[model samples]
Target chain A: MREKIIEKILESGMEFVSGEELSKQLGVSRAAIWKHIKALREEGYNIESVNRKGYRLAERPSDLLASNNICHELDTDIIGKKVISFETIDSTNDYAKQIATNENEGTTIVSEEQTSGRGRLGRHWHSKSHEGIWMSIILKPNIVPYKAPFITLIAGASIAKALNTLGVNTKIKWPNDVIVNGKKICGILTELSAEIERINYVVLGIGINVKTMEFSSEIENIATSLYKEGYNLSRVDVVKAIIKEFETLYFDYIHKNSKLETLKVCRNYSAIIGKKIYILQGEDRELVKCIDINEDGNLIVEKDNGSIKEIVSGEVSIRGEKGYV
Target chain B: MREKIIEKILESGMEFVSGEELSKQLGVSRAAIWKHIKALREEGYNIESVNRKGYRLAERPSDLLASNNICHELDTDIIGKKVISFETIDSTNDYAKQIATNENEGTTIVSEEQTSGRGRLGRHWHSKSHEGIWMSIILKPNIVPYKAPFITLIAGASIAKALNTLGVNTKIKWPNDVIVNGKKICGILTELSAEIERINYVVLGIGINVKTMEFSSEIENIATSLYKEGYNLSRVDVVKAIIKEFETLYFDYIHKNSKLETLKVCRNYSAIIGKKIYILQGEDRELVKCIDINEDGNLIVEKDNGSIKEIVSGEVSIRGEKGYV
Candidate 1:
């Protein structure tokens, strides 16, 4: 009866359906509808109400695993077919990698809590329980191993676009992190297996903190959750939006052409575009002038001198000389 | 005392010193030296005795793991150190990949058998006990995720060279299999973690059957061991030689200038130069002609009608071109 009341309110879509009507439809007391609404609100849902006008769906809180959420507008054939959901886990990325080798392409693993989460380079990911979104997608692309890095760029771009849709102006922090207001809010990690000519499969894990209150003091300066930024978006909402955006990009990549319009879009959506940043070129961190990103998504950084060097992967962090936008 | 006698005999590099001198140096009786020689012979060492002439080194089998055996002239700065010898393990590749993220570069894990070995696409690797060299190397290369596939080429080249030196005419099946007599004798698995610009670490797990007597009825047609092919070799010798080749190639790769040279050497050493092969290209398996080998060691595979594609990795199997050479 409680779940039915909530479903009724969500399906109404427009003008608030009276509590009395919800109770009549669910065959539950009006008090029960109010209790479920309170519970939903506590779960970071934005429910609107008035004097006599019962509840209204202000936001669905985009989540990639929501049954009607991620599959709602998903238009791709091989990105997300059967979505697997987890309330909590040790590591979604590790879990997904194991499955990608066995399952076919587009099997998604989405989780709400990850106790032993991690990022690139073995960095600990603070995936506070119920405060973030962690999901991984399987892909079987027909390309050389050298081309696998582009998928990361595509993932980063999708994240940036999703956040942008939510009215949060985000920046790409070279490689795979999505930053908002100078703080990182998301990360992408990819693992794969292949022979020289064909890719066996790729596991792309995306983590984001859409509804978080407190953060670890150690990463307080660098990490910020979606809720912390005054936007208490539901985890389900973000997941839905992200999958939609990813499907569009992936379709353009494989269907449109092998060059993947997504790749072209990636060149422009790159995080380090025309920005002066500090790169750990060798053993020293140097401030390099902004130039352009390469076709391979590498940073074409111009040093203090007149020379320019291509900074491909490895500890090349972007430090905004003035301030991160 | 016996070990000292063997060491002194080997280091002399000529006519072995009398057992009396070895016994006096080690403070042991000549009877002990004789006893040690009997054991050494059991372990495949060929020691000759000319009656009153004392023990003279007539022939020393190219030992597998003896300190002065293979890898005697290793030149690389890292990639092969602290080799752990094991009679058997569940899976050398799994053990190595699991620890590579934690261990530093140059750490190597070697085993004589793998109860649950693996091949590409999650296939089981047949590792006959005491008849193969099962090893994994922990390498930390300064590259990006895109370049991760090249690691396969690197390991394949090393395996090819080592086999050539041991007088086994073989061919690479592109990506990571060493085929002899049209049957795979070795498989290389490269696993890594990284972002677009940086690769955190990579684990290269290689399994080569030096002597496989017991054959699985299912895999007997597709697999062959060195011993099965009349090649007299030691598991320890093969492991060390592979390490030496890998270290040399890795050292050259890090230098940037000689990296191309190293790759060239790998190609010339590869046996799939002019052969017909099958590649599981994307979702379809197709027969392709093995055309030119590039400097990056990627095989240039030509389709049925002149469309040549450079394949870095996938599921590749060389046909019985010249009966697997």
Candidate 2:
């Protein structure tokens, strides 16, 4: 009821809705209309009020992520059916996992800022307040646990495609990092809680530096935001596009068992394919020629000795820094 | 210091230690010693106090899973280096995952009773108070997430071997269930929190019906306790042996990259290696003859048409229930 009233005020633009008129349209008491307007003003909403003119919504907190705002632009069916938005959180991934068992699949948790955001390999992710898209999508795909590693690729491909649609040329560095001009603009952390044979839930934690202008000293060289790269983009638009792209790719992979679309996106936006890359395993680093991404999403590369082997992501991590390239 | 005092009392058996003696041994004042004793008694430890004879450890509560008791007979270097014991918890698997990041690789969490015990396929596991081994082991192996499915087989093999050593005659029923006398006696629920590349932690939840005399009607036909099956094993002893056996097999698989011992134990103690079984998918069931346990712990089976195919545990579940050979 409150949201509907707010929506009405927002749609009214500069025109004021009289209390009697709002009550007649909404089928609520005039006191309820007055109460909702006061609450909206308390929530940082700019409302102009007059004795006879009633209420007019001056402005809204655009930084806040409401489900209506996200769903209004959403095109997917399941990815964002229910959005739990927070102004500040410890980590969206942690919160999603905590509630994944009880919540329906495709439920999502998003935050303006994550106080202790995390990345792959236990790295620290910097999520600037209201500047980056810090979100975790809960997926309960009816696929085996072993098939889950490919979902990471699906997420990467979706992210790359979504950003590309917005005229930001983003490349994917398999198997999870999304790069823009050789620097990481986005990272996907896919965490699974599964039994031996079945997947209970998968928490896909995605962090995109949309408008972050600066980063900490340690990651300044490796991390760059969309705004820093001279693209002023709305975090909400990035989120909506990613979710829209992700749902299509995810359904194709899960329902149809087709990796053609994902593979196409990965190969087209690949940052390392056909380039010389280094594979890091423990303290050992070996340079290998990137050939092609195999059907199973493993990296098939030819060693300097003219031998070819598929490098599984779980067995080894790839690190091709700027100097190496 | 408190644990040491309790240990001293436990080791003394029937002998009583004077307050002054306890204070001298613990390097605390007599008043502090008395306070500690009161706290220990409040934790359900039965301590007897005589006027001049001082405090004698009358009995140790059997329900509490003290780290000292679990580690007393522990022989392996890892797997149970640090034990977190709880009297009652929602679920050991849930709690283990909560603390897995900060704890060491081989840290363990054990509870006397799980209020809401869970099993494979989201079934309810009957965990009666003081009558079952409800525990979860945290493993941080340096293996990729794809190789983690085999870890479940390793856990099942270790548990079967451990119980066989105690003359329980337990057999593994593929993947995760440990059966005795044609009924399930233990279940291994392996949950992994991982990325596409590396595993953050694997929570191996093992539940053994140690001395349960009665079960709920729904599970009574399918579940059997060690005590009901005429093996009155001690829960602590079972826990220690399983951890010791698991440590050896886990290290062999992770460090040495050897699944030979695990495969040998699994094949030898398999419940359906040579039997006709039914594979249960969502709504499809197919009958196949189990031929052999392959090198990777997958079930190699032959259909009636003489077509041979390897059955991966993650793809479909096996269900060769009663009245089926």
Candidate 3:
């Protein structure tokens, strides 16, 4: 009844609706309708007063997190049916992996705080409350185990397109992170389970600092959040964009006569091109000039010995030749 | 006191140590020593005795498992220094992965049975209770993440040599399993946690059926155990050989400079050599011939159109021309 009451208000463009009509339509007391309107206001939805006429919806908050205000606003039906929220955890990645085995495909998990959230190469990712998006999406693709790495590339491109849709120009760093102004804004950690011939599921963990107030001194130079870049973009908007892009990329990669056109998107958005960098090959990090990403998505690096070393996605660390990142 | 009793018995060359001396040396009652001797006998230790004389060792049942019997007989000062025993578990590989994080290096986990024992690709490995040597070794090797795959090859060669020491002629099935008479006798599952430049730890799980009994009909055609192969072997002996060989291989691959030499061992031992196999490349399964393994330990499979595909260590299932496993 409360949902219908709000839906009617939203459908009416926040115009005044009689309290008696709301009560009669919802089969509830007028006082109950007033209480729900107050709750909606607390969720950052402005419910205007019109005395005896009714309540009018005025405005929504700038940041749309997974609160009651945003869940009702979602347009898609399947991807995020049950939105689970957490206050704090050791890792969103670890928690997502724990429940991935039994959950249905498209189940979504979000955490407000992560104590030991991590990125690739065992690096810590700062996830403060409401300042970042710590989330994982469960996907069970009917693919083989060997085809798993390509999904990482797809995830990177999906995030890149999502940011692009939001009018935020960002570059992809090969396999999974998104960089803006040469600093990392988002990280995609793709973990999967599979048999030799069939994949059971894949949990794509995406962590982004939407309203970055600060970063630890160690990473202050390398990490940049959306808020730090002069944006208080609603988390809800980012989530919707990400889901929409993932749906398109996943369909293209899995169903079409596919070379995974998403791979081309990644190469197009790659930020490592034409840069002098160090390719951490073994214990001895080799200096290499960035050339191009080969067709199979290997980062082709030309070394000093006139030898070209192509690096596929593993624990690769890209850095400027002289300065530390 | 029982351990001391067994030690004395072993050192005395199967001669019966007097019950009084055994009690005095072990600081136990004569009756207590007699109780232990009886327990040892129940565990398949052949004890020789006379009136008022303590037990003397004759022979041990070669079960090829880790137990107080042979763990007490081990000669190493480092590897297998500590052992944890489980009757059954989901997967020895899973259990071993936990052990690597729990204990220090050189720890060995032995399971008398693995109810849900698994090989690579989560395939069910038939580990009948007390019929097989199912265990995992935890090691903190000083190696990089890229070099981590080589550990699989090292453990494979070591197990093949260990089975040879027990007079079982087993061949290495490249990438993982050990085969006898064209059937899998043992399989090695190697998992690692690492940074780009350093490995945190590695858990190597080796599952082999000591007695060929209790194998299911489904696995009968493709699997063989030691006892059915007519080898009077003990699980403890196989564990010792594997641990000894692993330490040697770990030293060479980590301490010495032969990562290429170690990787070459994979091509030599794998079943893919001179065979046509299906390489699962993303969405399409390609029919390719195994030409050679490149220096990076990736399989160089030549596709029909003159292009070559480098198959990384993923879900690789080798098959003949027929559309079957």
Candidate 4:
């Protein structure tokens, strides 16, 4: 009820809506409306009261990943049925696991900042306040655990496709990284909690640098963001678009068992498909020519010996021949 | 220190060791030895104290899944390096997952009873106090998440082989059930927390009906315990054997990437190979003949149409035509 009232006030577009009108529209007492408004104000929403004139929504903070805004833009059946937003969290992935069992599939947990964000293979993911999309989606797909690796590609394709639609040209780097202009703009960390044969739940932790202008000295040469790359996109819009695109692609892959569509999107917007890359296997690095992503979502590469091999993700990290492409 | 004192007293072979001797051997004062004896008494150890003759262990409780008892009998290098025993827990698998990230790979969590023990697909596992081995083993195998399903079969084969060595003569039913005399004696629930490419940890929850003499009416016909089947095996010995067998089989698959040993164990102690069975898929049951245990742990079955197909363990639940064979 509070979310709907806030949504109505924001949709009013600088026009005043009297307390009596809001109470009637929301089917609540005027005192109840005032209480909700006070709560929203405490949550960083700005509302102005002109005595008897009415209430006007003066500002909608860009950092607030309010469910009302994201749900208002969602158009899919699954993948965003429930949205949980946090001001700050240890990690969205960690929080998602806490609620994964009871929460419905397609539930999403987003945070403004991650104090101890995690990347693949024990790497630290930098998630500063109000500058990126640090979110985790709880998925309960009825697929075997072995089929879970492909879900990462599904997310990668959806993220790339969504960003492309918003005019931000991003490309997927094989398994999980989303690159832009030869630098990484996003990282997908697909975490699965499953029984041997069954999927208990999957937490898809996606981190995208939206408005971050500065990176640490160590990563400044390789990390890039939408705002840093000169694309001014709303975080809410980008989040909604990613969820919408992900719902469609994920369901297609789950229901139809069709990796073709996801593979098509991946190949069209891949940063390493036809390029020469180095496969990093625990202190061992070898150059391999990237081949096509087969029907399965594994990376097929031609080794220096001219032998074709399928490289499973998570077994080893892949680096670009020159740098983090 | 307390556990070591208990071990020494038990190993004294009915001879009463003087308190002064114990204090000197343990490098502690006689008062400290008396305090440790009181702690052991609180833990249900039956120790008899004779006024000048000293202290002797009269009887040890059968319900203790103590780390001292389990680790003393373990022959493996891993799997039981660290054992944590609880009097009662919600679920060992769930508890293991909570500590999986911080705990070492071979850490084991055992509970005397699970208040709400869980089986595959949300089934309730009946874990009466002190009647079974309700334990979860934390494993950090450097394998892709796709290979995790086979780990369940490795566990099943290990349990079957271990029990057979102890004269119980159990057989594995397809993926995870260990059956004896046409009834289930054990169930292996393998849970994994992993990324698409790497495994963070695998919780192998093994439940064996060790000394259970009775069951609820619903499962009474399908479930049988080691004691009920006339094999009065000690829980510690069974646990040690299973861990030893699993450590050998698990390392073979991990270090050598060899499934041959696991498959050999599975085929040798299989209950359903070359037998007619029904594959229970949702509400539909299809008749299929189990052909062979392939190199991979998947069940190769000939359907009614005479076409051979590989059925992943989680995709379908196989049951015997007449009963649980």
Q: How many collisions per candidate?
A: 25, 0, 10, 2
TM-score of the candidate numbered 1? Answer: 0.67
Question: lDDT (0-100) at residue B7 of candidate 1?
Answer: 68
Per-residue lDDT of model 1, residues A1-325, tens digit only: 4445556766888879898888887788888788888976775557788778888878765543444455555665766667776657899878887777678888888776888898876688877666788888888876556677777777887888777787877777766678877788887877765533457677888989777767788877878887788776656667766777787776656556344455455555555667677765457777877676666667677888879898765546666776443
Report lDDT (Cα) of residue A243, candidate 1.
74
Off by over 4 Å in 4: A1-8, A11-46, A59-63, A304-306, B1-46, B59-63, B303-306
Model 2 spans > 4 angstroms off: A1-8, A11-15, A18-66, A319-325, B1-5, B11-15, B19-51, B55-66, B321-325
Better of 3 and 4 by lDDT: 4
True-contact fraction per candidate equals 0.37, 0.85, 0.08, 0.92
Candidate 4 fraction of reference contacts recovered: 0.92
lDDT string for model 3 (A25-123, tens) is 888898998888887677566678887777777765545354344455566545665566665788877887688778887777887788998876577
Residue B148, model 2, lDDT: 92
TM values, all candidates: 0.67, 0.86, 0.76, 0.89
Where does candidate 2 chain A have its weakest 10-residue lDDT segment?
A: A59-68
Tens-digit per-residue lDDT, B1-325, candidate 1: 4445656778777675777877788877788878888987776677777666677667766644443443345444565556655557898767876777778898788765789988765788887566677777887777656555666777787888878887888766655567887788887877665544566667788888787776789878878888888888766667777888887777666556355755665566555667776665346667777777776656788888889888654434445343443
lDDT at A213 for candidate 3? Answer: 65
lDDT of each: 0.71, 0.86, 0.72, 0.88
- The DockQ scores of all candidates, in the order shown, are 0.22, 0.63, 0.14, 0.70
Alpha-carbon interface RMSD of model 2? 1.3
The 10-residue segment with the lowest total lDDT in model 1 chain B: B63-72
lDDT of 2 by residue, A217-317 (tens): 98888788999898887677788889999999999999999999999999999989988888988899898999999899889999999999898876777
Residue B157's lDDT within candidate 4 is 84
Worst 10 residues of 3 chain A by lDDT: A61-70
Using DockQ as the yardstick, the better of models 2 and 4 is: 4
**Better model by TM-score, 3 or 4?**
4
Please tell me the TM-score of chain B in candidate 3 relative to the true structure's chain B.
0.81
